[model samples]
Target: MSVAHLIGKAGKPYTVEVEKCHIRQFAQAIGDTNPLYSDEEFAKKTVHGGIIAPPTFPIAMSEESDEDLDLGLEYSRMLHGEQRFIYTRPIRPGDVLTCQLKVTDVYEREGKNGTMEFIVMDTEMTDAAGAHVVTSRTNIIYRSVSANA
Candidate 1:
């Protein structure tokens, strides 16, 4: 099945709620020991005035923020090609974040095995106050079934 052609030109947007516990777990999973992320008291002294999440904490909310594409891509053949995040301001606990996402680009490259599909997704995260908190660019490379054989 040609799953690539099924994905429409425009992608869907999604929203997610950010919580303090989520931030703490993400910090722990990433082995980040920063006081700003781990200690509420220490964070209170900083400019943010509260517990602040690490730069990559936004990823933890991806599952909630991602659209249900159901593209039929084989999970075993999928690979994380690239990821980048640009932050306008630090993310603090208790901030309700909403993400707007769209497929910026989609293309295929022919290889000896078959064709490799590249999907690029652009995501913008904003706080409840409408402040842009972060912009994330994610690239996913889907290897053809033939390539995995």
Candidate 2:
């Protein structure tokens, strides 16, 4: 299969509601002991004024990709290759967020065994006021049986 042919030309946007419980749960799951993510008093002393989420907390707030979209890749064959987030501002509790994600690139390369498909997604996260909060890039590598020994 040609990866270039599988690229999703357009992207669908999704929204997520940020709540204190969600943030707390996510922080606990990652074993993050940061006071900003848990201690309300400690967080209130910070510039954020009240409890603030951890830098990586947005990942937990994101919704899954739309299943109705023709993403063109088998979920079982996909492997998370890498992920990065650039933050413009801190995320505080009760802040509703929206994310717009699009397939930035898709390509296939010959590997030692055969071929591997690479997919890149670019996501822009904004607050309710439409202020850009963060940008995240996710990469996935799909390796078929022919692409691995």
Candidate 3:
């Protein structure tokens, strides 16, 4: 199946109330020992005046069900190409975040082995008050296993 057909497709909307534990757990999962994500006392002393989620913590909150973002390609043969995040402000506890995902682009280019397909998707996040919080762009690469074999 051609990934081009997926361009313009929209995914399920994801929302979550970011909590202190959520930030701390995300930091721990990524092995980030930053006090801003864990030590409330220390974070309170910082310029933020409170603890905050890691820059990439939104990834944990952006969830898409099977009904969305199904590229109809070989799942095992796919690879994450890249991830970029732009943040307006630090995500802190008590903030509710909502994300809308969409397939922004798809293209093909020659790889070391052969032609490869690239799928580009984006998630725009907003706070409960409808303020833009962050925007993430994700790139996924897919290749056929038959070619590798």
Predicted candidate 3, C-alpha RMSD: 2.0
Which tens-of-lDDT digit does each residue in 113-143 have in candidate 2?
A: 6788888877788999999988787888988
Question: What is the TM-score (0 to 1) of candidate 2?
Answer: 0.84
Q: With candidate 3 superimposed using the best TM-score fit, by how many Å does residue 81's alpha carbon deviate from the native?
A: 1.3
lDDT of 2 at 52: 82
TM-score of each: 0.78, 0.84, 0.87
lDDT of each: 0.77, 0.78, 0.83
What TM-score would you give candidate 3 relative to the actual structure? 0.87
In model 2, what are the clashing residue pairs, if there are any? none
What are the per-model C-alpha RMSD values against the true structure? 2.9, 2.4, 2.0
By TM-score, the better pick of 1 and 3 is 3
Model 3 weakest 10-residue run by lDDT: 63-72
Off by over 4 Å in 1: 1-13, 45-49, 65-67, 110-114
Model 1: per-residue Cα lDDT over 38-134, one tens digit each = 7888989989888888888777766674455566667898789999998998887777888766677778888778788888776778888888999
- Per-residue lDDT, model 1, residue 143, is 86
